[model samples]
Target chain A: MHRIERYYDSIFTKQSPEQLARDIMKKADSSAKKRSFRPLAVVAAAAVVLVGGVTAAAATGLLNINELFGGRISTQDEQFAGELVGAAQDFQWTTSDDDYVINLKGVTGSERDMLLLYEIARADGRPVTEYMTNIPEDGELDCAENLGFDLNAGAFKAGNYRYHYSINDDGNIDVYNLAVTDGDISGQQFYAEVINLYPKQLLSDFEAKHDIFDWAGGADTPAGFYRWGDNEAFDAGQPCDVALNDERIIGLELEWTIEFTYSPSDTAKLSKVITDEKSVVSLNYEKSYGGVWTYPLLRITDSYFSSVSGRIDLVREGYMRGQTFDTCNDIYLLLENGDKISCTAFTGVSSYDRHEKMSSFSVEIQYSEELNGPITAVDISKVEAISINGEVFSLI
Target chain B: MQGDEFTQYVRKYSDMVYRVAYSCTHSAPDSEDIMQDVLLKLYICEKKFHDDEHVKAWLIRVAVNRSRDVLRSVNKKRTEELQEGLSVSDEEPSSDLHTAMAGLSRDHRLVIYLFYYEGYSVKEISKILRITESNVKTRLKRAREKLRAFLNDE
Candidate 1:
């Protein structure tokens, strides 16, 4: 044995093989026997106790909200949120009464989280250069809570708009990127009501000094909300802006509709299952045309809809070398009983095929559930590949 | 597998499974737990194996996957248990080579252990780990460089 192997072997040699095997066999034997009703009753009683304990803890405030929410609350700025900037859909809308020019620059994000980039400016070719000089220099503006402005009170009222922003270096608020961490917006049109606008300098200074903006408090300022009466008139790609106060500034009342499509390469639907001496291999082809790339999936299932072990060939060579590769293709299995189960591939070895002049790869697909029957066929008929050149290839 | 056949297979490959699991986990009890799970999977798997080499490959793949799952599980109690159950001693490694191997990252250490210690080829390790052959080669090269740097410093 090699020296390192010997050292590893010695470290783990404390567990006797015979005893370990005996213990495993015992576990297997006990699991094989029919489960008794008494154990089920005990488990039900235990579950009842657990629920009661959780409810009591919640009522007593002993359960931390951060812990309850899976501990996702972070004091750091959201990274990778800016990557969506490049892929945002463009829109330009101006208010009817005020003529404030609001350009919805782009929209980029996943199904659950989205980022909206927009610019608010003047309509008569002048800079919106006024800063809120009333508040204390040390004070910070809470953007989300200041969505609704109270005109009589001369300040922003409290509201729930879970969004954040970053100022550009030019000190002009060129892009107001609103990070939305809620429901799917793909293929849907939505309107952003421009209730108020704070000076770019004030927002930037507050952000710079504080470094962390609380999404839960109102900004105490003299900047009142502009009640644009024609919120219904705005639509995506329409040129419109709103006039707040006596200023001829155009602020974007943003409206946009997004459509996400996938078109893989020409050979997306081509798939085959080949069984060799060692194991079975499934070959699948997938590609994504544009937008946020979802992983190209390949699933293996038995006749009974139970998943099997398999892998796909989709590893790009430059991924490990700091190269960004798009993985937006969908593959699934259609069982005999008319049920569909999503398939995923394990990370596999990737190499370049000199003869084929392309990166060659294969992944191992692992399914834990045992199958009731043998797999009948390899299904690539459901694969969708959207090509970068605007071609949709789907297997019928 | 059943009765004598299963027992014989366990006896033949138990050390191999244990070592591979330990290399990934760095915890003895967790490695043992992974070994038991891998062996149980082999017992229940209905797929036919062509030979001993095939069986070994399958066991390594299953063990590696199970070890990763254990590491990724959300239960904090398990992590506490692992800390209490495993600890390295100065006497564990007799030579600088063994000590250098322990200092590598889990990914680098695993590839090295499989390549140099367990005598697996880069191609075989790729399939077993579900990575590309080029990735395996890169990892191996990096692991050797790390080892050389450590030994030279010593």
Candidate 2:
């Protein structure tokens, strides 16, 4: 159906029977020659063969060492044995000790072979950094054939080919290597809490979306999003106060605090201070849109409300944008110390006679340098006023 | 079975084995080499042909794998096989089909060859290739889609 398939099929179908027969004959001859040839090393090392054969001699362990070594060696079987033996490095093993542990496993029967390991380190392995194929897990050790193993999935498809190995120097200290057969599998795929994990081999073409850090593991998690605000919010038509506490030396481990205040019964007061390094920094905000409302009898569509009330409504668009807005006139601040700070009007207050109310407004910000980022706090202050049936009124 | 019986097995399955080898190698010479090599391996393995199907499938798998190994070893030689007898020019007389096929990835090419040349259904290809049936079906569909794009683009 597809040209690629059609073309491949055509060429494949055209392979001549005569050509195949000739090639088969040639291969048969080469295999026969290879079978007949014996190296001089095998001839010179009789004892090596005797010793080497013992390890695998008894299928379920029947042969005595002395008998196995003393028995008459069949020339053909010895030759076959020589061909089957792999290099010494193939059987090498490493150990890992301490609070951290690494174990290795080898799989056989793959187009490409591998050694894999699952490595774990102490929970407090500070600023923990782990390498996937350290020491024995990499290079020659990663080869499947060397480890006398095969992979069930061809190397290209099976997410990754991995092996396990550990190293222990007899001290309290230890390191683990998930002996990766190739750079096929990235450690992060299987190992949790790995410092950083990005898929490398096997379907590497599937690119991951960036920008959002994986905050919580879910579709609605705070990943795939960017942070904004200068980083502060404003009440639509007003100037936003921004201040950065650049005095302290900012390091990845640094912590700070933020605070904000505003006015006219329409206010938002919030503050935050970082408690631990690597701890998540969360900012809580509360904004109330305080204003006057009027009902117009001439506009039938505007008659949803028979009368107007002066209220400061806190509009929250929920977690993500485009959701229905929830209005709240009251906001309660939850602090790290478990103390709740309630926002109260400092001066200007407004009221409406089922029609007009309100007065002056302004916003303020307070911040604790104990947290990261600038403008930790925002406060809004506004003048209160009202309109009633083509009449303007002010309340305080 | 006797040597004669083994030889008969080789003769009957040689073409099928070579086709699979060629699918992996994209070369007549390498495919032929794998066909004979697989047969020789079967002979020494003392593996009896329970039925024609078993023997045929074994020969194909071994031939394909052996050819792949050979192809992997010869870097320069392998590229030559990929390029050989598969190109077409605007003015020259050549099969654009081969040209397009030479451009498909190994998985796509394998599925295509098994489906069309070997006359294997997706299920059979899955079993022979040691892959999931779904994977075989997907690969076949993708290979066809790629070929269709290559053909239309011309």
Give the winner by TM-score: 1
Looking at model 2, residue A219 earns an lDDT score of: 18
Q: By TM-score, how accurate is candidate 1?
A: 0.36
Binned by DockQ into CAPRI classes (incorrect, acceptable, medium, high), candidate 1 is incorrect
**lDDT, residue A64, model 1:** 14
Model 1 CA lDDT for position A176: 43
What shift in Å separates residue B112 of candidate 2 from its native position after superposition?
1.5
TM-score for each prediction? 0.36, 0.36
Best by DockQ: 1
lDDT of 1 by residue, A1-396 (tens): 366666665655456777777877888777767355368876787556533321100000011111211222221212232233344344555433243454566665553444455554446544322221122111112221122211111011121123333333322235443434333332111212333333223223222222222222222111222222213334423333211111111111111111111112232112111111110000111211111222222121211222354444443311111111212223344444454444433344344444322344454443312222444544444323312222222323
Candidate 1 DockQ, CA atoms: 0.12
DockQ of each: 0.12, 0.07
Docking class of 2: incorrect
Off by over 4 Å in 1: A34-396, B75-91, B95-99
Candidate-wise lDDT, in order: 0.42, 0.34
Single out the weakest 10-residue window by summed lDDT for candidate 1 chain B: B80-89
